[model samples]
Target: MHLILWRIKMSNDNLFSKAEIKYLIKNKDIVIGSFGLAAIILAAMNYGILYLIPGIILTIAALGMRGYKIYKIYERNKKIERTRIKYNFKKIKTMDGYQFEKFVADSLKLIGYKTELTKKSGDFGIDVIAKIENKVIGIQVKHYKGKVGYDAVKEVHSGGKIYKCNEYWVVISNNHGFTRQAKIGAEKLNIKLYDIDDFAYLLDFK
Candidate 1:
């Protein structure tokens, strides 16, 4: 598998181009042809009564080989997903606070909201102010590396009240999942919190 991957990398200057597509299609066709030939050979061998044991053993081997191939495919897919997420996170990490703020503001604006970037941190914990229609929304942005605890949620909620905003949003990066207590706190305070994964979805990363 490693050898095949290395060969592919060595041959391809543009993996997404027409040449690569043709190569992939040809490889897939060859694999299907090989599997078909193997099945035919196995079936032909089963015709002889004396060859029953050997045929059964061959079929079992084929099944095991297929299973191993399937497992490898699944593993490769998982690895690809992990790599994609890592790349996205690294890209986000390279962005400064102001850049992230602008990104978020642009994203919101795309969704039809007029946004205001606040340089002066609001006492109520608001980092951004957005007005949709006549409603003002307070936003707290957290570029955290670790878990955003219940306290973070509470602060945003309190800030919403102090700012007299219609709604509150807490945007966090690389934080522990909101626990049950945090959920209850958010519900009680009527504050909405979004994790990094949620932000990615909201921003349409994919």
Candidate 2:
């Protein structure tokens, strides 16, 4: 419990906050880098190495900040990878429907798939559409406690036709997985069903 809480804290993600706005105001790399360049220009003046020293320092700091930002993103993705390995669905269940759809689309992108989220209201039945190479997949995302029912599978199966998808799927991240009827219908309709266990592979795309 302590470890999990610590991990979440270190992930630096909060439920709500304008972190981006704050970052842009405080840590704009272009502004810092420009200052560095200006300082380097002072090196040509009588001050010489004195200004040059601070210029190099600030330039390096700007680069290091950018690298750190990239590293943080890589670490965030790795945390998702760890969750997949641990088969932890509880965190995923906390997301709202729209959040769940976005999360699924983001995961697909990590593994080289180009993903698009359908409109919230007029999406037919699908939440996310993904493409890799020649294949187009329509996916319905469910982030619920109970087992996903047959209706979800049927809905995605039908939605796939509207979107001209080559494959269809119903994905649920909760532990309950899919009902027997859902599994049956998915098989008959050739629609894939991804329960908690099967859903883990979505992150790795393997």
Candidate 3:
């Protein structure tokens, strides 16, 4: 039934797929690393004292900024991890879809996954890209009330492949869980579906 439809949809994914942007925002380290290396090279080449002084100062400032950014990222992720353990999604029904996606990204961070929040426009149905070790995962967040239908499942499954992700997931906040058709479609595509129960269980991770 839905499984057959899933296969057909995936077969056409490539034809309909947009060019994958695969864009990651640059961090401060890239500039800092290059500047530091150039400074060392300049010093070794016996550059004039004026050039050496400014280069050394700029490199030091860049290093400090890089360190601060890394620490802030670490702290932010830790905060999210703690919030997941203490917070109950059922109690907070007011969060918008964007907020829900952020929560999901935070949970993945606790489990050693680095999450990249995709842009709202031209995201190709993916909300977050989670990477852990060598594996990359595509996740779509659904904040609806009723059962998650086949569309959400199909979108993540096909879009994930187009995005070159190794795995895909659909996170549905609906307590009623997925419809039978949706489940069948997801199973056919090997896409993991997470309902409210599964999210609760994740909070209990050791």
Candidate 4:
């Protein structure tokens, strides 16, 4: 049984992209458990506890279907620490550009860098600057949806020179992410792009 499941996962892992893999692993428990629980609730409301026993068992079975969520949550929480800044996807999606930039700065500082936010006016393009010993990193925050274009890559690349930054990055709220031209430009310019999924680990929010 275990061999068959392993073979199935091994075959399917090669068939899916990283983003798709994360989405499936991250949401599958919730989706399946929710459906099972709803079914159980409906059965309970319509019938007596005696008649609902099968439904309750099915819900518990579903909850454990993909490696019990209880263990998964415990394993996941074990890695979380008291980060300097706490953030979540829902809150991040609602923040304005200014708030998002500040959050980025705080998150960077959480990981040992000294960070500063550039002024709103006449700042050229850098939204945040992070320094650690001799290295300086320039960052731009975009709390927006849709594809980020080559222009954003250009903005940080040029702005990095002004800030004496040795590295450059763009933090984006949208996971759909950068345009093809933006990706090409980033590769050529040696800039990294962080969509929400990437930043989640970077920030290490609990």
Top model number, lDDT: 2
Screening candidate 1 with a backbone cut-off below 3 angstroms (N, C-alpha, C), the clashing residue pairs are: 147-176
Residue 184 of model 2: what lDDT? Answer: 80
In model 2, which runs have C-alpha deviations exceeding 4 angstroms?
Answer: 1-90
Higher-lDDT candidate of 2 and 4 = 2
Local accuracy of candidate 1 as per-residue lDDT tens digits, 52-97: 4554555566566667778967765565456436445556687877
Alpha carbon deviation, residue 200, candidate 1 (Å): 2.9
Candidate 4: where is the Cα deviation over 4 Å? 1-86
Tens digits of lDDT, candidate 3, 1-206: 23433444456546433222111113444455566668767877887555566667667877887888889777655654565557755454888888888888887787678998898778888999999888899998888889989998888988898889999988877678999889889888999998865665555554
Q: Give the per-residue lDDT of model 4 (tens digit) for 27-86.
A: 665544665676678776975665366656655766676666677666545443222135
Task: Report clashes for each candidate as comma-separated counts.
Answer: 1, 0, 0, 0
RMSD in angstroms, candidate 4? 9.7
User: Which lDDT values do the candidates have, in the order given?
Assistant: 0.67, 0.78, 0.74, 0.76
Model 1 misplaced regions, further than 4 Å: 1-90, 204-206
Best by TM-score: 4
* Candidate rank order under lDDT: 2, 4, 3, 1
User: What tens-digit string does per-residue lDDT give for candidate 2 at 11-88?
Assistant: 555632445444444555655677788889888676678889888887888888788888977875776567575544
User: Which residue pairs show collisions in model 2?
Assistant: none
